[model samples]
Target: MVDTTTTTASPGSRLLGLTTLVGLAGLILFAFVLTEPDVRLHPTTGEEFGQFDAVRLLYLHVPMAVLTYAAFLTCAVASAGYLLKRRPWWDVTAHASAEVGTVFCGLVLVTGSIWGRPVWNTWWEWGDVRLMTTLVLFLLFTGYLALRRTPAEPQRQARRAAIVALVAVLDIPLINRSVEWWENRTLHQQSTLAELKIEDLTLFTLMLGLVVFGLVFAWLMLHRFRVGWLEHAQAGHEVALAIAERHAEMETLDVDAAIGRTGGAR
Candidate 1:
């Protein structure tokens, strides 16, 4: 009874986790083992051109990047709800999504760097507008998380975090459009799915990766939200307990003083 929210597990979460695990395994096999390497002979130069073995990274990097966008957008929506309704559930959802989104954003950057090493001949390119924008987005949410930790009233903290999250989400559109807008300045390839550049097993594997990663995002968000809510509840319980204890101490002190006066008078 003292600890009502002890575990972050439910039957639904366990099933989703299993499904995500299976999907991940299937995606890896399709992307890395069954799918052909992206090797193509240049028509004019008669030279091999493509990501080759490095193309395998496309499945993970691209899916994570998309899910990162989804996660942040979810955060933004929840933050807006928190500001409008001043509800604890909204605030908890916003915080949970931002934390999960930041992690996914970090993975996107790392995977992009690894993928770039072979395709772009560099681990990172400062001038790449997409990369820079994504980094800024990551840092912004990270700052949002840090701001939540600063000592303040709970309502005040939640309000500020909500506002910061709403503002930080603006970078997502810029990151998405950077490749097209800054065609010359950025080294990012245009959207392959949009252009229908990928075909057959490669396309299927990429889509599978999206589904698998989406499941991953859901699983993480569900657990994190539950944990955050539980922490919030625990804090409230502790405050109430402290107040009750103080009242009990005051009552005990009053009783002791009354007894002493009566005995002395007698």
Candidate 2:
């Protein structure tokens, strides 16, 4: 078979790489130098919550959380598209986005835990509806990834994965609204971004973080989608080779049987 894959980088890839690099540099500059150092106050107690340096983690945590949701949303949409169109590219896209989204979701949990430890005086709280729902969301997608890994026919696997992805997305709204729905039971604060009370520099830094992470997600999705395509092509090649080997084996057996019959007749 001819190796049809291209080795040359496309213009779009170069542009994406450049944009990601510039966004990352801006994120670092804004995170370290441009942002103001001011302590956050407790939402309820009106007392000093923590040092500004520790609170700076919000720049990383919030953006990661947002990106996690975005990635999963992409996965869900791709999954739906695959089911409707029955296209291999849609399955590839759904798989790639799920893998990237899973990583970002894990980061969201880790960073949120680190931020919560000092502020809430707990590493985790089972009773916190937001935390619990977020954990559930992570686990559901983790299961979706696991389902994709199990051996099956291509269409079967894609169908199963799509169903799981769609089901998993149902948790997203629940997770997002957990803090609001169970306001009395959770320590997690309501959306402050909507209120716009955050300082100018801090808000700017957070927005920069979002842009950087969003670019990173896009770059990873592109690479991962390519990888999925390569894997699918390789699997097809292996199946063809297996079929050819089986055909050759059958031909050899037929030749042997014919020779034996002719010798017996002689």
Candidate 3:
């Protein structure tokens, strides 16, 4: 029989979908503003009152990093739920969030590497605290994915992965404080927009846009989890059908043997 239960969305899932769409729209608007080359630097002074290129990474990178942290937080919450309540949905959420978080973390590392290459003259640096800790965070989540693939019962798998997820959350604060941990001369200059200028206000708005985008990312995770559950349910249905067909075949063989014996005896 088909498992219909797994195919449905959670209560109020539509709200999540709506929130994601709104966030995506905001991200697109911010992206357009960030991409315009019209925002340029002074020809002589070489200083840009409105230069947008170097800061463009802010439009994508900061939000992604923030989202990565958010995803892990979601995983931690879901894992906690699984541990305390043992609900299968919580396990699914934990796995889903972890997978999504890992993807964003990868993006953060790549984008940061690109930004560093232009500003720092090196694509990779061991001394950069933010870069190093970010890489470590990526690997830690990658490890969580590997942990998920390991063999064990369902609850056992969830529990083990939950512990890993919690441990990994510690890395978030570490990554945030990495700049303080190591002294680096090549570090990207801090955001100039923090001075409360008009452009800075726009950057603040852009940051809000990024937050919206992050929510969309979270929505995507929940959707992906739903798809996983649907596939699992379909597989279970196929197994059930196979078992039923095999039983029917055995019954047919038994009936045939009985008829032959009766006919021969008669």
Q: Which candidate number would show the highest lDDT if scored against the true structure? A: 1
Candidate 3 lDDT by residue in tens digits, 1-266: 45567444665677887877877766666665634533667899998664336556667777888888888999999988988998878888899999999998998888888877755667898766677778888899899999988877667888999999988889898776655555462274443445654455456656776767667785678687887677556756787899999999887787877889999999
lDDT of 1 by residue, 1-266 (tens): 36775699999999999999999999989988999998999999999998999989989999999999999999999999988899999999999999999999999999999999999999999999999999999999989989988988999999999999999999999999998899998998888798888787888988899999999999999999999988898989999999999999887787877889999999
lDDT of model number 1: 0.92
**Candidate 1: worst 10 consecutive residues by lDDT?**
1-10
For model 2, where is the 10-residue window of minimal lDDT?
Answer: 2-11
Candidate 2 versus the native: TM-score? Answer: 0.86
lDDT of 2 at 16: 92
List the candidate 3 regions with Cα displacement exceeding 4 Å: 4-29, 32-52, 181-198, 231-266
lDDT of 2 by residue, 95-193 (tens): 999999999989889988887787777889888998888899889999998898899899999999999999999999988998899999898889999
lDDT of 3: 0.76
TM-score of each model, in listed order: 0.93, 0.86, 0.72
For TM-score, the strongest prediction is: 1
Q: Which regions of candidate 1 fall more than 4 Å away from where they truly are? A: 1-3, 255-266
Better of 2 and 3 by lDDT: 2
| Full ranking by lDDT | 1, 2, 3
